[model samples]
Target: MLTWAVRMRRTRQFAWLYATTWRVAIPGMIAFPRKPIGITAHGREVVVPSGLLKLLMKVVLGRATQVFAVSRYTRDVMRDRKVISPQTGVVNWNGLSGDAANWHIRSTSSDDNTQLFTICRLVPRKNVRGAIEAIALLRRQNRLGNCRYIIAGRGEDETALRNLVAQHNLEDVIQLVGYRTDEEVTAYFQSTDVFVHPQIVLKDGADFEGFGLVVAEAMSYGIPVIAGRDGGTADFVQNGQNGILVDGHAIPEIADAIEQLVQSPKRRNQLGSSGRHWVSENLSWSKHAKKILVGLSSA
Candidate 1:
């Protein structure tokens, strides 16, 4: 039997010993209420007794079968938290299946050469404001010309983000395409030159980016990425190799990375190739499925 737990408390509730191997995978951070456990207990805090939790974990690790994790960050957390033994195997999450029409790579460059793309919900944590600010900064420096920023996604912060764009007089440069179907998103990916994911840590002490699937999608089509070093984004984007990883709040750094990719076609091509190679080897669904199968079979 295998179980996944976000907190030590729940680990105690699902206490069962199995002759078969057991696995416990933690997908995100082990932080407290920052990432809450969905279930509550008796109007009080739900928790596992420490002793029982430890015993169950030992049974899974020692006698059961195999253990697996989702990401290096998660694996490290498990080790540090002593939730799982050091011997547990870790597997990164993989890509989704591509739709037929959206599978082919489109030519990223254009005769006019003036379109950028970003696809993310307009939530504050997504840092859409940062992406817009980067565009504004680039324009102020005269580093950007005739380019349009196409942001496609819908969320609570949509109004605020659009207001920011209009406030900056970026009405012509920024376009909010709103929530798109998967096919539409793939079309946007096909049309754009670069993909940017400017994620930042939230005020609640919660950090995200447990592998940005958009980055992988862009790479599959040979588009380079400019993402923040938020959590697991680093697993896909190697600095100055496959793509650029900027400090989350660094507007100038983001602008500079965008400018570099825009100005050099050769560099963009090289980065795109590197990104595709990395995805095939490390981020593909097939690769991840194979790893999971191996762990499950052994368990």
Candidate 2:
């Protein structure tokens, strides 16, 4: 019998031997698998770990019965790294539980002022710092009309983000809220004018936003979104259709998208309406489950 160990005390050689012998080893993450498991060309698995740990994962992934990727981008990265052949993997889009449509009603007519919000772990890949810089650019351009950017959630990058806010003297325009509960997040969505998640692939491509749940959540609440053009967020945003997609690396471009939404409440409402409709129709848990099942069956 093959024993799949999610957690174990073992040396790298032993783990490698076990992986080679096992019929199948499904890892929970492509990054270092603490379960004693688990690349892009810049695959996280290739860049994050070192020495024996990295060597072991390379062997496991190269030999696993099938590799599962959360997004098409991930699957491509695996192929690029030669970790898995094109025919041996599948893409499983993440799904949201419950009826996102029934989550909340659209906020009452937005005023001239805009309340921008983002809910994400403050990590480098999430690029919360870039968003804060964009806010600063807005302030300089005199386009920040009673604009308030509220960032909720905490992470390793929180201190750096807070410093960026303070450095810009934007203590009033940007608020770095600590971690928020799910209920608090829902409330933020209900009140927000636009949601922005400026995610970017890391420099090494070791880390990236596989999928942006916040982008969909805001759309579900009938709020337009401005998201990064890179990674899986494009799977939803249609660039001026359902929402706007911007370059996460370009602070000026991000600021422009925000100002465009702030100045045109009519456009925001239109995109938001379309977004809510599209998300309700395409992002149900049932659809995701069916897709996953089909992939699994074929495998």
Candidate 3:
């Protein structure tokens, strides 16, 4: 990358280096940043790049021409960590796949059961256990109807989550469907009635949702969302507009949010429709690119 930048500059050409992840941007931060460049765009993915990494980022990343964050939560956290200068960074919310808007808006299901879907690596910060606890709470209250919470993804936390399900006698209601294929993912999204991602900040706020793309995808599929209130998801999920935001550590609130949507298909469709429209208007690769390009040119 250093060689490429040098070569371009030697030929009287401008060099614009952009990395989509921290790993990809490290080399540039080490070799360039302070050097000559037309634009240097780096993404902020880590909640906290600790140790030497944290020190290096704090000192070097601010020297870059531009820094783009996937969400406001990510940008603000990095600022709080002193890893990036608040002035040099901009929040570029992740976009939905093209054609997300063209899908036919799904009608509310009249079936007796509702399908609640969640997809993410099984990690403590994801707070999958919180969702399970909410389900257990619902069951205890006899408010949980014929609903199924389908968790799709595999990671270190899976075993514990499964144990929690069994402990609550919720084995029949919760299923951890490990890693899904692209087709299977699409099918799950299509069939989903509500998307649940009660992610929380963990590891002393070192792990969090930078941007909740899956929530947006579910919304694009016309599925209502129920997300935790602690992360970038708040940027996209307006409490009652597009989705409901609940405290990740509170089981009662999560259960109440779930039960509310489960009982009202009309509410589900309303939130889902508004969410899809939000995605079509604000989230797209083109929109993301335009913002970056505009920022670069303006800067």
- TM-score for all models, in order of appearance: 0.73, 0.81, 0.90
> Which 10-residue span in candidate 2 carries the lowest summed lDDT?
15-24
Give the Cα-based TM-score of candidate 1 against the true structure: 0.73
Best by lDDT: 3
Model 1 residue runs over 4 Å out of place are: 1-67, 78-89, 96-102, 203-205
**What is the per-residue lDDT of model 2 for residues 183-288, given as tens digits with 9 covering 90 to 100?**
8888888889889898999867768766677788888889999999887788788898999999999999998999899888899899999998888888876876
User: Per-residue lDDT tens digits of candidate 1, residues 152-230?
Assistant: 9999999998899989999988899898998888788778788888777554333455557777778877788888886
Query: Model 3: which residue pairs collide?
Result: none
Q: Give RMSD to native, each candidate.
A: 8.9, 6.5, 2.7
The deviation in Å at residue 141 for candidate 3 is 1.2
**Model 3, 1-299: lDDT tens per residue?**
67865664567444455666655666655555544222222223454566777666555555556677777887788778667665657888777766764764444555778999999999988899999999999999899988998999999998899889999999899999999998888888877899999888877877788888888888887789999998889998899999999999998999999999988889998998888888778889888888777766666
